[model samples]
Target: MRRLATALLGLTLALPLQAEWVFADFEAVSGTPQAKLFPHLESAGRGNLAAGGGQLALVWEDNRDGSPQVYAALRDLGRTGFSAPRRLSTGAEAYEPVVLGLGEGRFLAAFEQDGKVVMRVFSAAAQGPLATLDAAASAQPTLAAGKVGLHAVWGRRDGRFLRLVSAPLTVDGLKPHAGAARAVDTSPAQDEQLYASLVATAGGYALAWEDRRAGHTRLLTATSSDGRKWSEPQPLNEIPRSGTARELGLGRGPGVTRVCLAGDGADTVAAVWMDKRDFLSGYDIYAGVSTDGGAGFGANEKAQDVFGAEKPQWHPAVAVTPHGVVAAWDDPRDDSPDIWLAARAGGKDWSDDFTLDGARGTGSQDNPALLWHGGRLHLAWVHRDEQGGQVRYAQARWE
Candidate 1:
């Protein structure tokens, strides 16, 4: 049966090539002047990396000027590294800055100034100053740029409670359209909503965040068509506990909540966060998927260390590429905080959790941010040290 054997070999040769993730060595984006770089925020909605138009853009909270301000840097496609860092915030206390790439060497950033929310637009040659978008004592501002100019959402304090506000941004003269800004969530003042994360889709945008409407922290999402009108917020997970929910397990301290969003600019959208549903003092990574343009999200799935979820995992970040979807977070499974990643392709199950920080014995790493562009995956995180914090970067390739 030599002909039969030959036919089997031919069939094997016709199969497609399988893709794998290949990560490069890590590098510090913030050099060693040692005054705390990109201070790690306990809240979500921070933008650490943005990849588009053959370039990578980074923004973070910097305090090198004696007062906290937003700073940015760019990595050109032809260069081996990033350009010199530059300050983007004019306010003395510009906190929680997030950046978005709008293609063609253009970028947009949003941050909290004093007690107001402001936005700034930048081009290749010049940039504009901060334009006041909303003045409602905001925090944890997030920005997403799509076919529209720019979309922003942040937590605004209304008397004794917090609410979510949205605004459509324009760079022409660095001004927001009057009356274009509105509240995304109009619930009672006691129903606090914070830490908003947004993803730009082909049709519009999808926003997700940690909501506290039911007296406990829960993941919620909403969809918007023009950045002004938004649908009602819906829970992404069913919290089992009636008390505090979706809290992080950092050592033995009180639990904290956070959420992040990622999308493929199409139908696929993902939200990842840390929750203590399995173990009150231990955290596990959870993911919610929305395939119908954020109309609704499926049930939450445990995405980290499916084999065993014994240790602590927090600050989960997600990114989608043509290859598939990947989620990374800081885990203490190896007795120390290290970055671990798991990926899934198509309809297959998630791959096993693999450590990306390799042999981490020195510093504590957290706040991992991920982006995929040009068939490459880019990651950024904070390396906490005795002196302060440093921004770290690494790249992954599909082989």
Candidate 2:
């Protein structure tokens, strides 16, 4: 029996060796910080990196000029490095920048300026502000580009309750659709919704967010054939059924939070989030899949293999690749948080978690943004040392 156990362990260790990720050395995406302070990257659930049309784009907030401003960097796909960071915000305090690739070397960036959401378009030659959304009391804005138009969603505070609002934009001119900005979720005013993630799916868009309507935080999703109309929100996390022995009441189980969604530009969509399901353990990473364009999701599955009393995982980012779905998150199993990733191939279960090469260090690494394009996985995250934080970038190709 001892020999059999040893053989099984060896097989498990050897299984994923052939297809491991070959990662490049991490480089600073924010360039040399002019100030000694940390450059702020967008929050975990929001996108900060995009790749399309042979170009890669990254956006963040910096205070090198004495005030918070939005900045961006572009890199050619065939090149090995990114351009020097360029300021995108004209004035006012700005942060939480999200970027979406518009194909043909064009990109769209949105950030919160002062209190409103400001958007700009970028190309190889020029960049300019596209529009300013009227969401003055909003947070965590996300963007998704589809065949028909661009979709934007954010959490807007209405009096005591927080609502989820969506706005549609024309693809050609990137202008807001007339009267298209409206609340999409039907959660009651007493309940709060936040941390929205939007992804373009086949013939439409899918939106997901963290909800507190069940008396505990949970993840819910909605689908739309057109940007203007949305389907009813559905829960992505599964709750235990009552009436059995040792059953708990509704909303009494572990809660879900900080969800990020990725689609394969078709029917396959994946959602990854931080979950607190184990009473003795800290937060764990959980994921769900939808094959019918987010109209429904399968049972939730654990994405990480490690769980301990105080080791928590956070800021999960997911992407759908030709091989399968891959999820990445910052984990503290090594004292300081480092980026870890897992892959699910075809119909198989998730593979064992592996740390990204060059991501494990003394400092903290968090808020991973993943983009799978041109047969490579591009990743960007915030790295913090004693001095300050800097946005770091690295890419990996499957062996």
Candidate 3:
């Protein structure tokens, strides 16, 4: 799970003359007549963000009615506030609802409830009925809208083993293609946990996940040109295991990797993970980038500029557009988790680290989700207090 943050507040960070960063006041989006408190009764920051056609959509889990349920809110192109959250699931418990921009004015949302996957199609003004994609055991549902269509993937438990399954859908209604739901990985060992991620590309999509089939977690990726068929599973991280660490003996050991592909006609893809190669400073944010779509990747490098800090830094989230790529994560260098962001524009080096939501000495901030929408940077995260959790959002413009 992404680490927790605390207490909502306003913050601003000055960038170099090349780029000016200004943040709007952080606003609360959860809780309601249904919730007992000002913020939601209980909320989390693992929510997802999507933007299209001058509208932004956010989805997350909210425990407003005495049970965990999936809820969503919408914001118009120039608005600073979000509409009231509308419940999307009827189950008593729903987890990790993810949303994707389906072009025009359509959006797709999916989540896991009672070990099954439930989906819905909605716009800013209207929504469709709940559609149960699968009734069996499933976890970590993810969706991506590409040039071909929308693609969905999840981890399905088959007795003792976990397999990866995917389906292709049309944009308007998310109608699954004929013979679409199929297993992507050819084989895997028993009890290998899997969480899949999908990213949109020019003609198709790219999928990535970490599997323990080889007795250690390795980042794996596959490409598809039409969403129905995928290339063979391939390893993106080629670093040899280093025995310096207790987990691995020779190469880099990746745990819980997250992936994102660039948009706005850019064909770059990046994978960020915590690697135990150094063995002394704890896990670091290492990334692998592919320049030519997902055909291949270059060497892995430390994505963040953690120059002198020795504390654990993880749970990296990235957003990419034609302008640049931005990565943010929770860092403990200040004795408490503070959201930090680093950016790289064009082929230039990454900018020095800058503190986002700087609530130092007051509360901790973590689990940041980034979205490059309408030429601005929109960030959503969870803020926690002695009272409860609150889902808050802020926006930044690069001038």
Candidate 4:
């Protein structure tokens, strides 16, 4: 693989953790975005990437207008791909779009419109309108920032009370008077499901999900320094009989549950999912950690060495750097979903399987993406063999 990372970054630290699973190095582009893409175009993961300096923004879920829409693309660095995608939103059916880089240039994405879950703080560079926030029937919505402003939470189907509230909006979306919607998880039981994931480190925003009261289907968490003051829904998956779950579908992005408050913050947090023994059916790519961040969480660790559960990994796109957590998915073993990668660096060890190839010609690779950039790890997805799928990129740099 081109001598892989210049002799593995000058070789040192003893690295070791490679249990024979090398598939590193990948390239595949065609995520088109100059407009003019219609054939039932499908791009999920509403939007979940930030990475700075070297560049990388890339959001998703743009069904070419028939329904879902929301786009963004930047991928800079040595440059070789992505930078054309730009449609902010048109709306008809937008799913997840949780982003947050608000250091200065500002960012905060958030999604689910039509079904509810909204929030859009704005400023990848800015131009005009933006700063929307919503709440009604809410769906997988999560936004963070505490101490004073911004911080939202969602998943509130009302009537039957499938709880999870929290509020405080206003970067433009308006609706932050302070303290109101707060209901961790009442558990009326039933199918009473939930699928949240929010992270913000320090002392704010730390939510994870997948619940069904107890009948089976676990993994829950909650914490809020501000989003509107929340904290009281714990259940970070302890395994055991491991909730007879199912429905691990992660395809189409916007984050299919891969929260991260990251480490060293005092509660160390990390989460990933797609593990479905049956919550609905087949799924793979499980992970869980929370050294204390959410207070407790640890189990469901099964990246399956590389993939399985019938092979067809989807959704998954995580990032946490210092060289510790980097995930990417969308690998159909070979039927074409290729764009897999796994890294861990120190939380014990991992990294020795990478595959994201395509460009000379592009087609189905679906929405597999990963971003770290503060240390470099960029990889993109959606490369439909050509004239069909578009969106691709590749990058690696960790010494």
What TM-score against the true fold does each predicted structure earn?
A: 0.85, 0.88, 0.86, 0.31
RMSD of each: 7.6, 5.0, 5.1, 18.7
Q: Which of the two candidates, 1 or 3, achieves a greater lDDT against the reference?
A: 1
**TM-score-superior candidate, 1 or 4:** 1
Best-first order by lDDT: 2, 1, 3, 4
TM-score-best of 3 and 4: 3
Query: What are the lDDT scores of the predictions, listed in order?
Result: 0.72, 0.77, 0.67, 0.54
Off by over 4 Å in 1: 1-18, 33-38, 41-43, 173-179, 241-256, 306-308, 357-359, 385-388
Residue by residue across 79-193, what tens digits does model 2's lDDT show? 7788888888886688888998888888888777777777888877777555776546766789888876777887777887668888876545544332357888655566788
Question: Which ten-residue region of model 2 has the weakest summed lDDT?
Answer: 1-10
- Candidate 4, residue 357: lDDT: 35
lDDT tens digits, residue span 22-137, model 3: 56666666642232322221111122888898888888786776777888888886877888888888886887788878767678888888778878888877888777776678
lDDT of 1 at 246: 34
The regions of model 3 sitting more than 4 angstroms off are 1-15, 31-47, 171-179, 188-193, 238-243, 247-265, 358-361
lDDT score for residue 161 of model 2: 68
Kindly list the per-residue Cα lDDT of model 4 for residues 137-239, writing each as its tens digit.
7676655554455666667776774566666655533222334666665445455546566666676667776665555456667776655556667766444
Q: Candidate 1's residue-wise lDDT over 191-273, tens digit each?
A: 77889888888779999887766666767789988888888888777656434433443233223368888888888888888
Clashes of 1: 0
